[model samples]
Target chain A: MEEISKSPVSDVPTLADVAARAGVSTATVSRCLNTPDRVTEKTLKTVMDAVNHLGYAPNYSARALAAGRTNMIGAIIPTMENAIFARGIQAFQEELQKNGCTLLVASSSYRQDLEEEQIRTLTARGADALLLIGYQRDPQIYEFLKKRKIPAVLTWASEPSQNFLSVGFDNRKAMKELATDVIGKGHRTIGCISADTATNDRARERVEGIWAAMRDAGLEPDTLQVVETAYSIENGEAAFQQLMSGANPPTAVMCGNDVLAVGALRAAADLGLKVPDDVAITGFDNIELAFVAPVPLTTVHVPHRRMGQLAARALIEALHGRSPESVELPTEVRHRNTL
Target chain B: MEEISKSPVSDVPTLADVAARAGVSTATVSRCLNTPDRVTEKTLKTVMDAVNHLGYAPNYSARALAAGRTNMIGAIIPTMENAIFARGIQAFQEELQKNGCTLLVASSSYRQDLEEEQIRTLTARGADALLLIGYQRDPQIYEFLKKRKIPAVLTWASEPSQNFLSVGFDNRKAMKELATDVIGKGHRTIGCISADTATNDRARERVEGIWAAMRDAGLEPDTLQVVETAYSIENGEAAFQQLMSGANPPTAVMCGNDVLAVGALRAAADLGLKVPDDVAITGFDNIELAFVAPVPLTTVHVPHRRMGQLAARALIEALHGRSPESVELPTEVRHRNTL
Candidate 1:
């Protein structure tokens, strides 16, 4: 190990030192470090070589203990890397901001264990209230939040039989309506591209809705085929290919969300299948992608932004001792060109 | 306001109370609040009515001081409502997670003041390191980070002249090459849809690259038609319309990123303009949207996941008393059908 012969504060090789060694400006040194793409390859190498030669590293251990109580809220979502939850969470954050509250977000990547860990993590880190998605987590988790006296608001679904306060909509009914619409269009053999229905109640309810629609249409729900995968354009494409390549391909494909539908559309195009004419497609959550999709998707439009704003308002009101009524917003079916 | 006359914990009507009154399970009460979409309209109304009638409010004032030093990293992104930064940030969080560090994220909504405030807030909240975007923020900010011994990594751009450690590609070069290729296709008139170049160095450099390509081709850069706006599909569409409807519309359009380019493509289609035949278009950041756009887009591909992973490694290494060299990744231009 290198010897610590000099004072900790003064001896560390600064970016300026690297720049001086490389014959560049402090700004250039930073650009080389922070925005090397703006610099020439030659300049980039020169600065990087200088940095390596000088041993320049910025000290980043800035964590400190808070002095006292602060106005902060915490939220845990399935994932932060997609548009499905983006608008809603953004609206949630904005509403919190209006009430002078800061939102701390953690993504679970759709893993239940991870979600529980993050919930505890945020709580340990002193989050005042927690905003969570969906309602299918273990009952023990709810008991834990209650035990900790951490009021939580659930999003993306509403269960009138649950103990938790939720500001959400009916996923099962929304999907049922969409499925009914597809059935009305004379679709018989319906195929579904759904996310994991086992752990995710939302996905499960969506499938249930489709089954309900099928039963209503006097069709045997058991005859319907489904391919369960993660929510992604690539997965959706693969699922579509799997369904269409089968011996008895579906006349219409119903996706759990718009992301999957977009993928299904891409798959259809690659297979040279015209949407609505060759095989119709439907998606849930009329995200911006739905309208701009290869074929504008016929899907359910969830009020993401409104749901977020309402969730925030509900939590804020609760914090102020007002029991905001459990609000259940509505979803609409947007009939686009796809079906 | 009602007088506080009862014990804090015992008086609060839990979801169980609402459920009991509504003749449902505590789970149903939670579902009504969190996932109304999962419950029936009738059950949702009944639970909500009970909640309002019982004046049941969950207590959320759980803010407390952190026990001590902990492993945590903080990131402040421009916005959370889009896919542009999602992949990169997720990758960053994953890397941090592998090293036993949790990531806390804040969205700044692309406002400088908000970002500055969040930077301070995260710092005050005791983040071990910071992952930030771009290279154009105030120099004083870097000084503040250094003064506090806060290790920071700048993403999205690699500034060869800055003091901050960055893991990014050359935005200017990536876009310039795309523009050069567009120009080589025998199109003299060009149009650019860019974000605010003044504050966003990445956007500014992207425009500069196009201008540089124009100059190299012996074209007057001043003659290039330009439209500046926020980054969104709607704005991109409107900007495209403005560009095409002008007295001298460009034969080719270059967008700052894939999102804007998709919008432009939509506009082109709506106006009955066939892509490439009537007007060629290009974009930066070959996001998933680029490939799925009405026209598969020709754009520059930035290694988003890799950038995020490398940024995380840099900060973690710095945290561990290791001086890691700044990293600058490469970008490629994909010439799809749009160009």
Candidate 2:
């Protein structure tokens, strides 16, 4: 058998090679790469041609040294696959871009330790500020922020004790209002689908809000059904199915968020249960999907975009040495077909 | 009324002041802030107190000079509000984190000009490499990346002419296969709900692929009706309503993506039409919602996580001076209840 001819491996060039090819000083070449706008068009084109021809790659470290700020802001959220923080973070990024900032986002997946590690990485990478989801975290994390003097903003949950600028809706109060609406619908037997409360303060507060509202209405906590699960449509569907399959199924199911509510709706349909007539379903965080569902979802609408904008503004202001106050935006329930 | 006494504004202390307060050299304070691992636990506490008391913020520009690399990567996607890029980008970020790289993400919101601006901003912020969605962008962007010698990989679409490395699926071929399946279902009249094809090469390719498949099946090009709109459920629903309300409504609707397909399904339900019975529906990019839809959507499944991982691996290899070849992953049709 004839031996196969192997393809030759191509080489990637370095910044030094580009500088040599362009017949310019390394600093000039670095300047051209770091601030193209500062370089003349003719020199810029020449340097660019040499780079493309040689397949040159700039050294990021050296470039970072020359530039004062890394165009990065670190944002630690619970999850991105879920819509809860996704939209708000997206909005936050948009606002950041308007101010010429890039957002470095990471999902802690709801682990406090992982979140702290992410913060360290972000700081190492020279992130100027941080946008964290909730105020609840290890005291060491707060101490680290204070020690580093990094401007950090909290979102999704607001805690007065933290003394950090926060842009969020009152999670406990929002849930309480949502539960009141559910009870007003004459749902004495209420079922709940919440995120794991032990780790997620937001989920804990939401469930507590519901329980508090039910108790005030003269309904015992034991009468309310509760299932703690992750914030996922599939999990929501499973939780709803489990609630319905129980000996005493709830007449109304109040979900921790819209995602769970959507799953609950799907599960209810799968079980041949008509919403409103057979089992009323309610969701929180009135995400866009709530409006688009087969039966419009009755849920609490959070001004997520506005919150993101405010958070960005506050962080930017803090960066400029202006002390910005924390903001608590409002949330209201939208009555729809499901409820 | 007594004039409100303004809280005395403390002049923000400099790094020198923080160093003096902590009884450490400026270099020590810098080391403590930059690389805490190098500082003793006792000294770190002292530096932290000084930092918090003085409200001292590190001058990022000075710090950037000392650290050689920014340890940041910039990823520009079309939009985060849309789930199409969500899972893939999330996977990309997860993989990058393992390599000790922070991802700076920006959304262009589907605007070419915005994309260019984001590219410039990311480059200026010292992104070692860039991750871009789709190959179709202003040539200037390519030139800019080349000029800056920023290693960038184009995703979401595969094209050979582009010099940039790519890890993506063949949108045209995938759509052609999906269209073939639609034609095989014995449906002569086909309608399409696509995002604005004018600017989106992916959208255009999908529509053209369907046209090619239909033509190959001995159907006239005019038989393939199309409605262009944004990639949103609400917009998708509107397009489906328009298509169904037409004089010669299609017996089947093929959507450019699953989000649009979901909308079409909802619109069909609203119009009292059953899926696959009255009108079959097919979609592209089988997202999570595709399987969970009331009628499981017949669609094309793109290996999003794999693509993300492959992209990150390629970028890292390139960064390490290895010339990685362009990769094109495959896509397949997922037949479900919709068709």
Candidate 3:
């Protein structure tokens, strides 16, 4: 390839240029670019040849403004640093493409203000609808979306809020089941490592669910040691060390997610402690890392791909003036060697 | 939060409306939104207050068209399904934000056609500049960008082509160093697993580098067994198994990336093979997972954060009419337990 000049060329091709080259109307060129399947095979080949020869690029902004909608759906995830949300988001994007909608995704890094700003940015960029992770943002954001007539569907945690569309599993219920399984293994003393729940409803709900299970089993929920940290393997390791340093260490440790659980497993190995003999550990999210861990982790299996697919379909339906109903998916706790 | 109606409010706020309420000109409102540091503190507060009171969102399309620049940089990565590009893209986004620019990221899933489409979509959406992964793409796309005068910077793999700006490391040199280290460990028979090299320059270069190192060490490079797969842990594990099942298996296994290396380690364990004793393993890209693996991996440590930060700054400079020179960062060979 040769270096092209930075200066703008005078004869930049337009839809009209393509139309003249293909011997068709400008509308036909626009149709070929936007909805190629709608054009006849012979006309499609001619217009595409013209498009290639003239190197014409469609003006998305002009087309969006003229059409009064961009057919674009935006999603705001907490972060993409791990596999926790990757599978789900991939499914969501594929579903959106199937529905003729493009996905524009942004990461908030678990910051409420940043999320709000991204919501505005996506809306300003002409997103017809949105897919938010949780229903914990400020009321003002909802108002802004409402005023702009942008439909949004929340995911990851099921909140029975009629005011918002949601598609997710019950986080609290899933955690309770995992806790019950850990307790059923004859472990009375237990420690918990949870993600910082300040702005995360899912993490908070998971912790509460674990507490409920402990209390129901006649264990002192108040006495259960809890360490809150960022969702990382290193943090999980640090939290595990802190818990084990106490005079009366627990026999079992539960983590907020798979990333943290994998960390605990690493720490256990570093300490020369055998899993399921010296201590048992559990995790949530059942990400691929759980299976790849030195000791395969016992975790709650949330339907990530299903959540993403449902959220995309629901948002698209809502955009078409059909109110999308809330969906609650089921989760299962897998009892593995970790327990 | 209450459900807001789907209908658009007739009294939607505009920049002019904010200006009227703040007792300022529309230009002041625009400046307050785009470049808050340029506005006086008092004026900024007033303008922001007015914007909040009216629930105003600046129309990005209109603003881009009016200013002939969006102050937005778009990045088209291979995939976001794993941690391969997460750390670098995070650094890129942070650097872009610091430079008063926002980022719009899209993933191509390693498909050349999808990548080309994303480039055109981003350009048509008014991205002032672009960050492409490699130099390989349709020539017509380059022609289109040149005609539009869009500044683009390639990343992830350094190329000698002066046709474009790039910020990355020498993939071949990095891999050669790792392979040489493996050979020095008294390993003659070595098998390699790599990502499909058809559309990826980095993967192709890494494979070539390994062959170069093997041939230089008097090892028959043609005898080296190679398995090409996707850059995933599961694929790595399968590849490892296939290599091990063959007659006269290699004493050492090399992987294209850390994900594959981790998989190979897992497969070795499942097959009751010992690391460094029964067989040795090597990986590239010292991701966190490499350290957390049961046996730590010896790999090449690329400066992901530095590459991202440099790419952003250089692109911004190029957009400002300065020709940014291509940068080739250094990679280090980390000799850990696996080797």
Candidate 4:
């Protein structure tokens, strides 16, 4: 663990040293390091032994230049601060690594402009393909990828006719099912806390799904109260407090996602109301917290790992010059103690 | 949103298109794309306009070859499935992007071998610098990074003398302080739940810190029962239940992290045991969930955002050939309803 000098002329062994130690040509050593599968087992073992003994590290830039591919993929998520996207992105990155591709990740904080900027930055740093979340984006982004010929796949929402490779569950349908279940539980009045719907199609779709289900169950859309808030516990708490302060509070609350639901649950507890007895609550995205909440949260469980694995597979297929089929994974209601 | 071919020869616009549209040399266009400051503003604007108009995207490999720096920073963490590392890494990436550097993230899944492989892949993918979560790692990884002269910063534990940059809290001391507060609250018999301590320095340090605090307060270390468990809610509940089932059960429980404490809290509620009345509980790393738990958790708050910002600044400084100082950020106890 000694400090090594920054200069290139330090005592550290170079690729030439490894080649000399392995008793092979420099090109053979280079081939072993860059394309190990192409080398014979005997040669690969010898080169790797020499590498271990001499501690020769490959020059990444030089190797990337020679190979014409960095074997890297870039994934741009909206946020990791929330667990909603973190779990799926983790699975996607693991799948990519298993296939010998490294993942470069960036967060856009739910800003379309920032996402566009990160896409360019990731591509400029030698990502062989891109994995983007959601299908809605600036049209210029699509054009940029088309002009670059970068294999890109979108996840977390599916729109087959858009022609983008999508691996996701139907967000709209998931919310509709959850809303229907709430109605079946004998809750006529429903309140909703959702992220702003103007620019976020997923949020808009979820809100509309709830409206559709409620309307179908004979509840008026106007009677279904809704509040738009940022996706954070603090915001959720504030929105819940506001909802409860209304002259007529709804008997049931449906949150766009689990984080907001957790917040609403906390708010209810703070107000000295018993969950399910005084008011029932429901959440989408059955995250880990939902299972461990004070009261197990009844939620919609999206197939996070499946969607991620499919997205990686699709992107890799696209990179290999094959058209990957889009997939719409399933979502199910997890019955728990809350509702 | 059209399905495009993978080959470079598809309908994609190449750099030649930008050159033609701008009425400039291809070399000029390349230089304008790679090093904007080197070109005149008028010519740079013209090239950018053409790039936008034709949707021309620069090739990553060619750009990395022309510019020695990749503008990519690599981070290797345990898992994103848990929220412990998510917020900090998210903040770190946000800060890095402000300086025009993208983050390349990989998860080791808490495996030493996977971590080593990920380090190699990220380095091979042209990460100019690295941000590792902990100080402990395979010796070969240290040797490889040293041989390559890559600037790396360790996080989650502070070790300044290693000559590697670090931005983290004192894990051992923070736990000791929390244990002291528990003792001060007149709780002698304590049970601890921790992740496997052998490979995880963070968990081990917290456990040892509790033992030391107990010993200092004249309590035998053996009297404080310890349970090693995975950092999951279901596992935490099982462990807590087992502890409570034992004869002479502890009056208080100390968790290695908030995730474990959360499970313990739920188990207590399920058992009809009141927190701090029947049994007291404490947690480390005060995540957002801590505040929203059924009984607000009393825990140590690590400055996640500050740690991220400092780590990014220090790593960026080191990349710029400046010696960045290591920082051991402070942690404070937040008193709530749990303990």
Candidate 5:
């Protein structure tokens, strides 16, 4: 076995090498590799033995080029530094695996140009379908996918678009509901600490939702102080401090997500302010941290896992030439003690 | 321009089509794509125009198979549900990208069989090198990598293996230092909540380190209560509750990492216990959550990002036929309010 496997190492094994070792034609080897059931049992055994001996691995990209499918699904997410997309992407990968598809993931550092490049790269590597975060890319990318006949589904934000498929929640509605609930508690002056909304539709929609709620409550939405910063606990703390520095500090602070909310809670503790008493705090995205925070955070709960599973199913249907229905999972408010 | 780009789309564009469109031989187009400086300015311009019109992307796998280098590094992590490996892997990827390489990631859910399958899949997909979490796979895997001449580096815990390369911190040493510090703080009765150590060397080493510290402090190490569970905030809370339910609860609860430490803190809050006054708590891996926790956690600070960056550089050197030296980044105990 060692001798058979120890032949002079080439860069990688070619079909011809396997054929030579098995004493068969390269066509027979290729047939055995792709459609083993169609080949005779003895021939299959002979080819496989030679294959194992040579440590031969099928060139996935080469095969993808020939068949136009790599049995692989690719996703480009904004960032992996937090638990924001962790649960959802895990579910997405599990669902894809159940369908005999592997997932290739790349992070874009929340940059649009990098996401565009990742899309092209995944497609070039022969991803049969793609799972994108939002439908906010340049129109040429959609045209490019159309030209290549690759299907893609947008997730995380459910904004209806005639040109794309989506599986997510209405971020604006979720945030608006939370904001309305916050207002019902009789807190007039409010402050917002949001993720940088320039490249993130969810963050923008969420801020808009808060504005709509404030406007509905007879509060001047334009007067509401807002701080846009990168999503980090430290940033959230800094933003909270900035909001509190005003002469008449807002009675409440609403954050874009639970991570920032946790930061605000930490800051509240550090500054010796009582939560829901001295100041109220609310967050979007009820990730684990929301419940585990010292002061359980009041936040919006998005169905992340379900959306991921649905996105996988939708992309698989599209791959099979069936247009899967776009889905919008519901979100709700988890009224914890922080509010 | 639309007409020029609207040629009958095959599954993907081929060099032959680009060559025909440029009215040049395939070799000239290949040269233009691979070594543009070798092509004349006019020829390069014509070839690039044809390439653009056809939306051509070179098949990376095919190129890799021929050259034995994909310029792609693959890492198989235990899971992505936590922040444990996120910061490190992100830094590793950024470093790899700087060296003109792309990263392919897969999570194995800490199952050895699944990890082995991922290793095979990544190699089949033409990963030039692999970044594994630990040196804990079947011996056959090491042999398989050696047979294929695929370079690999173990990370997270620096346990030297003559057969492999490692770039990490000494888990046992770091944990022991923390345990010693807790002991010095005058806590005799100690409890531990750790991630399942059966499959994780890092967790196992930390637990052993705590035991070593207890024995060295003239305390009965075997009397220390321990709970092994999944690394989650809720799990940590439950584990801490379990330890406190014992006939004699420990004066201090030591966690394998900060996530568990946070959970332990939450449990203490719910149980109406004051940290340090009623019970002290210490954690490993000073992730951002440690500092932000209501009672900032005392924990071991591992240089996650630097380890990741160093791992990438070492692997790249190994790939280039240079046997890079293994690095052991320092770890220190961070004294905080928890202890």
Candidate 6:
């Protein structure tokens, strides 16, 4: 299938080949290729035609070998189907580009095995540095990075005690504060729609925070009806329905993220439940969906763009042989109409 | 800054180094690494620890030099801030993965120069195939791809006469059909919110479609007030405000896509204007934002996931030396309350 590219590497057409084909000096061809204004229009056209005829492309791989660095950074995110990681990665790429680095993104669909495979694939492909999401991976991954002398920075979640360089907010604290506020609103019975907590540290911490908040509010943590599911609006709706179907339904619903809350709202409409009046709702991650939803969502806001920019800087500094420190960004609970 | 990676090419540790450190043969080291079950647990531990100590990652570059094929595909999209391109790209990657190929993604921020740069960068990185958006680009790019013998298929837009392989719905015809429907609702004066058409062929075609529909409806095409801007909710809101500020504003507003339509709905709420009652609105690319907005949006549903899958197959087939024909998908206008 890939046979055409199987031509002997030595057979690759060079600039000299193009110059010889066009009957022009290598210097004229180079000038026409890089800075066309130095060459006459006729010379430019002749050089370009020869270039096309020869199918000559400057080999970055060839130069990359010479430079000993490709200046490409790889980012392994969980998924690309939602806006959760979109804004952060955008800012991360922007900062990297400003420093003459390119980003290669590979989504693992939140699977650890796939993530581990990509970690090796990107390394094998020559990524100078990596931007990872969270720090709950097997210690062998850290040892691999350590042995390879590759620098990697974590994002989305933070651990103060760990020495790993990271830029993130306390997901547990943020959700806990939101849950406390929901409880403060006089809703004793609360249901939670959460992403599977086992593989997700962020989801786990957020769930813990809610339990802590429930305890602080003098409510039985077991009384908090929890529905575990994947992160999707459809899943959120189903979870909300399941939680509400219980004989003793909660007075309010708290979701793991804005996507889930939006789904819960959709389910509310489908089930003929009025938001806040029939059941109050809250979410985490103050994404645009939080605001654009039919009922503006009360959620916790994480500085996604800033976190991405800072994470890029940390990775770049680490690549430059600097010991960049971990950063813990704060999250604020945004009180909108839903609560 | 990248000097740490400046170690001599020979300094990279080899399998022999790990074997020597672990007091095992190269075969034992290889088996311990690839098929650990064949080795004793103690041997596995010693080999892994030594592997970590030496940081011996299988050098893909060394093997890639001999293989002449990397089996990597690159997809360059416009932006990551929204969901418009998210689903399509996710599907594209899934199809490529199922075919034993890996996908590398780079965002161009919708800039032509940046896209062109990424095209070169991804190509230089040995992408066997490429999935690009739109058919409108300098023929020089096609020549370069031809010269490199790289197979690339276009998505999102198609032109039959051009002979460029693509998988897309007709943006002009789809939007024209929607405009015809809006016009059929007895709105003579219609205004449009569109993306800047100078650089984007999709936006230009959709605008042209609206004008064509206006003409067919016996209305002066020039009477269609158009606001050209970037594609963002904030930009959409501002453009909607500008278009509606006119003394004799059109009764209906047609947007280039659902993002803008959702923003227009937000603006409608802010301006205390009733949707459809005061001003009817329509959009293209019925993204999730369309359905989740405070007011449900009616939009043309482009087969994004299907297009992604088909485009991946076409590029993969081309990579396999097959002349896959371009497949044009169909679009449908989803009827909802806003229209």
lDDT scores for all predictions?
A: 0.81, 0.81, 0.83, 0.84, 0.83, 0.84
| Cα displacement (Å) at residue A138, model 6 | 1.7
Q: At residue B327, give the lDDT of candidate 2.
A: 95
Question: Which docking category, incorrect, acceptable, medium or high, applies to candidate 6?
Answer: acceptable
Off by over 4 Å in 2: A1-71, A245-247, B1-68, B245-247
Model 1 earns a TM-score of 0.81
lDDT of 6: 0.84
lDDT tens digits by residue: candidate 3, A196-304 = 7888899989988888998899988887788999999999999999988898898999999999999999889889999989999999998877876778899999999
Model 4 achieves a DockQ score of: 0.41
Quote the true-contact fraction of every model.
0.18, 0.22, 0.24, 0.54, 0.26, 0.43
TM-score comparison, 1 vs 5, better candidate: 5
RMSD of each: 13.4, 7.2, 4.1, 3.9, 5.4, 4.1
Question: Candidate 4 clashing pairs?
Answer: none
**Candidate 4: global Cα-lDDT?**
0.84
Candidate 4, residues B118-148: lDDT per residue as tens digits? 7877776667789998788777778788776
Docking tier of model 3: it is acceptable
After superposition, which runs of candidate 5 have C-alpha atoms over 4 Å from their true positions? A1-56, B1-11, B16-54
Q: Which 10 consecutive positions of candidate 4 chain B have the poorest summed lDDT?
A: B1-10
Error of 1 at B252 (Å): 0.7
lDDT of 4 at A263: 86
Candidate 6 — which residues are off by over 4 angstroms? A1-11, A18-56, B1-12, B18-55
DockQ numbers for every candidate?
A: 0.11, 0.20, 0.31, 0.41, 0.30, 0.43
Which digits, one per residue and each the tens of the lDDT, describe model 1 over residues B261-302? 999999999899999999999988888888888888999999
How high is the lDDT of residue A23 in model 3?
99
lDDT of each residue in B93-185, candidate 5, tens digit only:
778766766677778887889898788778776677889997777887876677677889999978556456899989988999999999999
Name model 1 segments beyond 4 Å from true: A1-69, B1-68
When 3 and 5 are scored with DockQ, the better candidate is 3
